[model samples]
Target: MHTHGTETPVNAPSAEIPMTAHKTQAPTTDRSAELFEQAREVLAGGVSRNTLLRAPHPIYAERASGCRIVDVDGVERIDFANNMAALIHGHSHPAVTAAVTAQLEHGTAYTMATRAEIDYALQLRRRAPGFEKMRFMNSGTEAVMAAMKASRAYTGRHKIAKVEGTYHGGYDYAEVSQAPAPHNWGPAERPASVPLAKGTPESVLQEVVVLPYNDPEAAVAVLNEHRGEIACVVLDLMPHRLGLIPAKDAYVVALRDWTREDGALLVLDEVITFRTEVGGMQTRYGVSPDLTAMGKVIGGGLPVGALAGRAEVMEVFSAGAGGPRLPQSGTFSANPLTITAGAAAMKLYDAEAVARMNRLGTLARARIEEAIAVAGAPASVTGAGSMFRIHMKAEAPTDYRSSYPSAEEKALLSHFVDGLYDHGVMAIHTGAGALSTPMDEAVIDQLADAVLASLRKL
Candidate 1:
């Protein structure tokens, strides 16, 4: 196997997260605040992503290597967030950097296709049997939107069904019922299709059917109500927003059977869950989806998304046989830089690498559970493979509604996240984290230790 030669030490002394009593005090962020002030004048909301927003000001990253990130404030923290689970090998993997730098000498984007695109596609298709044919996009949202369109084109249906509170992306139909509250989220059997963005067209809402997560019977019953009108059922095997619990095998099989019977497509959004296994989380289900939307770690920390699945379904994007039903093309689609970096990163994440990372995930989750018990905190952990989430509830939540945080729980979680930040650990604000290939048991222990300290303080 090839190696990322002479890589920077991931376990350097600087990577150690301080567990000092000073954790209660806020770190100095004068420089970050200054940058935010300047950013406010130009960048809306003082940041490019709403996810980057913090209470005072978002900390500005100076540089990152391996599992550690240094901020403009001269503070170094362990980066468990990993760019929202997009950095499988962690920031600036030597191989990815070297490959991308080499690609830069050749060129960047081009109107013509490169061998890099074909090579990367081949690599991905080999990894996941379900990815028979694929087309690249710029982000997960675009891939999902394209997949939904392909489903409609192939099935000749008008509506799409998705699990409630499962975040696919920013597309209009995709975002429906992503975060409906108790009052708005109607009956459990058939969830109401609530709009995420303000003034999302009623027509878009009408075309989306929301199904309850995990409960296979209820979900299938809802799909049955829709009958042949549904084009696809969008799913995230383990939705992070829904508390990072893997979907029950029964639920997946139910969707697979339902879609097969209804002549609708099963679109698995593995953009996040793809890291869970060499062939993605779907491989464990003993079934295959008609379409799969992939992104995140596949980009090698850059921007990329891909729609891959049965060639029959993906043929909707083809233009050769006849005028394509869904013409898909982007200026930056399959650009050389992303393709080269992704290929480098993925090549390094072999089956052994995946197993090691997942073992670290299991260790991290176990340690966090031990910490919860030691602190006597009413918290539970749920996750599979290389990711985990800490819930404030006494038991791990079974579904979105069950996991939905109450006002007190939400406030506590916010404070807990701030506490984790103060303790030199950066996790997704939801108390969730995805392990990177660069991490080991030592790093997992430090992360769990931070969780313990934060929970004790609370």
Candidate 2:
């Protein structure tokens, strides 16, 4: 858990504080509560996404600027969620806003492709040289689905392997075994394909092979056993639920080697991790995948997704190809507004901007670690670049099973999240945070102070 800075001794006596002692009354959100109740009549659970459900009621955002968001109740807080790490430049940057506004004047969609789409695609290809060709989609979920299908088409195999407990998207095969209970998860070396949803068909579950995170030998063994049937090995370099636990270099190399030898496509889901570098996180590891599915920051606060890869493999999507073509089309795919906004966002997030944010992230993690030592809390921080998560344990977790918090730990984390919210700082309830280009050292300091105050309250 120690960084390059001076280590703070964890010698303070453990606080004997009850969870209820720190549980203050919820924030004033009459407008939000009313809106939730009204929307529940039409919207299932009063929220579009299940993750939006929070205790008391979800805060309805009125507007946002830079790294701050104002709720319908008029409460302003420093935003770290950043729309689940998509708004790299934060809300309404002048460049992205102007681009989208100009595009709106032109038109929204059309039957033919616009020059904006071509320009945006070229911009991305230059940034990440691995993407020889790419196709835009409506979301990360759709991009993942397209990648799975392309892999099957290229390899002529039906099965896919993914790390257990890692989230790819809502798609059934990609989401299989995402959050399986301990009883259903089976052995670490040979993990079982447990369905995330109740109605997930048995046939869908059988097509996925689960692998243990960071366990190279075990992963290799499982892949070897299913060599012929596995079409691809899908992975997120930094999985969200595992506190952004980085994939080990050796483990990544092993997957690359195995997939190459077995003729299985290697799909890297960089939807969230793309913010880690201007060239994307893949460059850092020096391991390239056959297919890369990206979203989040690429859309610049807009809804968008992309699937890119070598020209040969991506040819499956081209109708002119001699063999069978994967038909891919969407009403809003590569709309001018999103393309313009995404290009502007990427332009603003150059290598210098990324390096600055990564430095801030390092400082933030160090400060949080110092606070944990001072509070004598059994916790550790895990993440790389601008993304981080505080785990409710003394040691940093390398796998999903170790990262899963106990009931008491979850309660403490909930209280911590609440305290941060009340202190004018916003973080994910799951203890994760994403830094944006709008955030500076001062914001990082403020976040560290908020964490200290929250820990003291607990």
Candidate 3:
């Protein structure tokens, strides 16, 4: 087993590759560049989301099958990112495609409820018993927004407490402190709620109580300090943006205890980590939250999100409820197509499949750690289940402050990721990867080899 350290590892003679010698040169993205140029004429910044912007340009995906995605250039690569860890079953799974096709035969959307929606909801409840009642939305951002609104209605409080450096969604309140720089990030014990976007109003920032992650005592103290004002404490068990660091069990326990004591709701944001287990990451921590926001894998590669929780708390969304009812509606909420695809995908992600994928992830992590040790690189892998992210540091980061990479480290990581792509492996520029149902031991080994080659190149 590889040991972690704070200082950079001493490079072995064989690993002493010059940084400039192996620096990744920009790829020939002729088609993608042309498309981007055309898109810029109409689309802002030539992309819909900032995340889609790559070094030269984003690769236009032509088609995907199993664990492979083919770009417009006709280059096929193993998909390790899997659409930001959303495609647990991988691209174009027969079950999901067939289900969606069948649903498409019937009308795509309807004002009335559909059988597929009810069926999918039932399946979700079975997997996550904490979801006594739930509502679907178009995306994770919407789900988180709904969760916060429900918490406010139930507790009659406007303020929300969230962990610093964790990403809940794009919603103004949830996005606070997602990427606080060292200068702006206050003390580790009590983090300041820094706005992620420029136009964010001071009022929105003030409503968020930022707490340090992994430090149970500090988080608990912050929660207690804002006891009466906070309606909910939103957190992701394994936040992707925070180097995929799993929340400490003690920290989670503290959150549960403090929220209960303070009459504040605990909301688990499992948008990316829901695939960690059949019962979700909450089951792994053995802590239940009042509400849970879910997305990614549950959507079956479709745009979907869900807010679920205790029946009493969720009753705020009910129409026949006596008190104030929190109205929730969306034209595409729980549409039949997404419902069918999601249900089919969920059915395939049985305990056996989940275990298989997680086992592959473990093997991949072990191999990557071995590569890091062999290359004597200042890097380590952090994550659980089928999700993993490589950090440009010797030690696994405990919190967001420690996780922040220096300019050199960031450049090196970007180059390394580009190398991986060139070697026929697709990973997020930030060095995150996710396993799919189609991945086996051999595929895991291949990915490990790709990581090794990429590290050596860097």
Candidate 4:
């Protein structure tokens, strides 16, 4: 079995050789399987998240540190998924671990606010001008929910608009049309508010106006139809499920203008893309949203989320006057452990760290592009700043509708991802990856070589 800090395993497949040149599967899964079987009796689907499930069974992790994770079978793979892009510094980062450990010794949570919260908020405010005032929540979903609700409260409107196929967590309104199919998705000009789950209230669907991504003109027309009723336009700059294609600058400008004209707010979902830039990807767009929902890296591998925005808009959550317009509170919100860990992580991920990581990201994408060309495979890569997704199409997709994969393509992607795992790389099943601070050119090269090998299989 390979130990934690080894350069690479003795028999690990090299980028120079074909993936099939060595053992293509984990040496042993008996322990992981045994634990999963026992878990099935208690936990739903033998795992806490559907994302953790695999073909035969889910692999159980024994431990992880830096950019590597060791499964129960003792297979150590370079972690590119990073817990679905949440771990900015990767698993068990020393600074975050030590900070959390220290906080644990003090206390976990309390009804009274901690100085840690104020200190962390100031750090964030200094990082992003959009974060004028902020409030912490337990998860990204909560942060998004708070943002949407706060928007409605601020605007006193019933309707909310969201780009088609962008995920903004599990909030009913926010999740509407997250994965609409051609059969149900109305038209390119004006998308129908498709419900993600069964029994989702029709009223909830009606209140959400779906805008086609990257189509500024169409989005404007759709928003015009709802004009005064829309509370805010919620968006993700680079939606992961949407093939990780970035929102066009024109599209963002259009939305910002329309929202302002319609007397509605513009909310940016920076949950996943926060790691893309020091101040979030919004900074790159040259747009400042009325509110920003944040998560993922901020928690430093712990559960955390935050909503920040223009003070006037965020004032709804405040009670300085007499019972504010919106009352928001979570028992674990801004708890010492999460704050300490997040502060340590964010402090380490300074401007220089962000620039270095993004440079590595650029190298990674360039290498993957080269691999795709060499394999002569119908594949493409899309992303910006430390994140990228491999699409099984020759051309990069322009929007969600175009990005939606065929059944065959889905199967092919799954097979390709599985191949990557067999080659000692754990990537997101969607063929997406978020680079972490610990990754360097060597790791990126390994990933590219794996891509080349996997594409050949296809």
Candidate 5:
């Protein structure tokens, strides 16, 4: 089922992929299978969302603790998945718990106002200089949705340009190239926006224009081509769909300059990657964006997201602006508990702490790449600092087109991932995942050995 537009799978063999091994001893997840069967009778596809659905049966997780998940089947496994890279402190961090506990007694949500909300925003400002003003939201999806809307209002333009292969909360305008077939995504240079899931309205597609991620020339051409009509160019600071292809520094600088010169705003989705540094990767790259959509670790481990940007651009959210005010309302926006808990988490992530995490992440990636080489596998690792991905390809993918799985390759990866699972390294089936602070040399060595053994089977 591999096609021209599809990316190579992270774990898929390069060519003539072998058939999957036959069932051995009926596999071990009878209990999970029974639960999945029961869920299908009530829940759609035995799960709430597409991301949760996996091969055989989705594990019914009981509890998780720092880097480990105990599924209902009594299987204790390392959680490299980290709830899709949201749990930066791993599971149930004590500091986060203590902070959230006091705020819980105060309140969860109050449509009126609260002091905790201001503290959260102020703390974010302290961490990120670019965040002169910020507005809280419920999830990364909500933050990005608002970001797109805010961009349109601020720039008086309706169209949005997004990088191919980046996943930005699956909002209609941004999900065009996320893990989709080339047929649906259109051409290479001049891409057509195809809806990812069915519920997306055609109207959403009308405003989105897809751009090649690292191709600076194509980016300028697309920007110039779409010029006056493009509201904003939204991008993930770190590409998350395939390998963690961190956008090149110069490429990002080019986009910022081009967009500024063109009067169109630039939006950076730092949702999954904000915790890596005090100011996110934007500070590291010395590139500033018009607006930033943030989530993941911002609320500790709780569900939270925020839209941050320059005070000038965010002035529209003031009490009384000129035109119709774009309503930024969420039932749990800036709730006391999340705000308090998030502040604690961010404060705990000092420069030294950040450095330590980055060191571990860097070491882990190097070790894994070494393991791949030893196994005689064509592979590369990508990402920045403490956040990286194992790209089972000859080289790190410069763009999304080079990164992910083809249908046949995905079929091949089911076997590969099964071997990985059997070896004790848990990750998402999408062939992408990240590292966390809880992992040390021991954990890294275990993962390296696990990957090496899995490759031997291939």
Candidate 6:
């Protein structure tokens, strides 16, 4: 129910990606870069995921437990990225590992539904706003894709709307619609639907329409224009990728109202925002979206995703004429292992747990702000609950446009993130988001000092 008292407006999402080869910081890369070259000969890009393949070479993690990750070089650093905000309880939590181990004894996957999966869905339904039933998947991408398909089938519409700068996943539909860079994405406002990676035909991109994040007027206008053709308007509750910018209350309220008037499903993607609370960001914002996309913490450091919302919309999976007609099949969807691990993780995440983490986050942010102020750096932190991002700019952005950095600014931010590692503090290369539970006041204080020092050097 609390709103950020500050009246600062946010910027929109946008960045001019480079055509040149990705840069590297060899001096700072350490042995990780050397090992990456060996990895590249066999493993394309020396990494499994395109995002993981950073400049120079990615650090090969040898061990991770709780708040720390040890690279192959035997260097330990505090993990603020937490696997892109997935590790809500942090790495190697005893409960999660034990649950997974126990599930392994029973079986990892059976292709049939498991009791744990049903229980997990029930668990989420209990917390989600207006949640009726749910389905499971192996990743946020699958969850998002299913939601889109269900919307399309339910409404008999082919077009879908998305917020700019939101990265859903690597599926053909998702990547082409949202993922930026190397994809030859067209103009900023009205981008040409471009596939991020290979294999996605130009055909898929034609179905997606990109909209400005945190701009309700644009959304209203576009929806009016696309009315009969649009199935759903999928977007992050917060403009997370554009330096973790948050949408305004006015905009959220506006979109919710407009969607109701237009008879289109409102798909709220909470994959990253799930860390905010036990009930998810929808609970925090009090928005009852038609369908909700979920992932990250729900997997308990494993891989899982889910879609849940009002029964009227979610029932598209049930059996009946014009009733639950979409098909959602994932081999590992709702596997017992991930469900058990996820349930175990969620068990420990109560309101008190959220409070503790938020306190630590608030402490860390306050200290870092103090340091920024002292150094007089044009930097700021923004986000809600236990998640936040470090962005270097004079003002706090209101949307993606104001939030995104120029190409030079991003390079500088990446360099700064690498510098944080040099100072024994590790952050996501994107300069967005941190995790909780493994971290405490002491760890937060340590990171605050390190972040302050890093900013001072800049």
Candidate 4 residue lDDT tens string, 1-458: 11122133221212221112234475854787899889999998888898888877888887777778777777778899999999888877766777899889898898898899999999999988888999998899999999999998999997989989888888888889999999999888888889999989999998999998998998898898887899999999999998899889999999999888889999999999999889999998989999999999999889999999999999998787678899888889998888998898898888888887788788889988998999999989999999999999889888998889999888899889988887888899899999887776678878888898888987
Segments in model 2 whose C-alpha atoms lie over 4 Å from true places: 1-29, 321-324
What TM-score fits each model?
0.94, 0.93, 0.93, 0.94, 0.90, 0.88
Write model 2 residue lDDT over 257-296, tens digit each, in one string: 9999999999999999999988788999988899999999
Tens-digit lDDT track of model 5 for 282-367? 88887788899999888888888999999988976776756545767777788787788788777777776677777777777777
Name the regions of candidate 1 deviating beyond 4 angstroms.
Answer: 1-29
Decoy 2 TM-score against native: 0.93
Give the winner by TM-score: 2 or 5: 2
| Clash counts for all predictions | 0, 0, 0, 0, 1, 15
Cα displacement (angstroms), candidate 2, residue 322, comes to 5.7
Clash count for candidate 2 is 0
- Pairs of colliding residues, candidate 1: none
lDDT value, candidate 6, whole model: 0.74
Per-residue alpha-carbon lDDT of candidate 1 for residues 1-458, written as tens digits (9 for 90 to 100): 11112323332223433322323355654799999999999998898899888878888998887788878767777889999999998877777888999999999999999988999999999988888999988899999999999999998998999999999999999999999999999998888999999999999999999998889998888898889899999999999998898988899999999999999999999999999889898887766999999999899888999999999999898886678999878999999999998889888888888877887788788889988999899999999998999999998899999999999999888888887887889999899998887776667777877898999889
lDDT of 6 at 376: 83
lDDT of 2: 0.86
Error at 257, model 2, angstroms: 0.3
* Candidate models: Cα lDDT each: 0.87, 0.86, 0.85, 0.87, 0.75, 0.74
Model 3 misses residue 387 by how many Å? 0.8
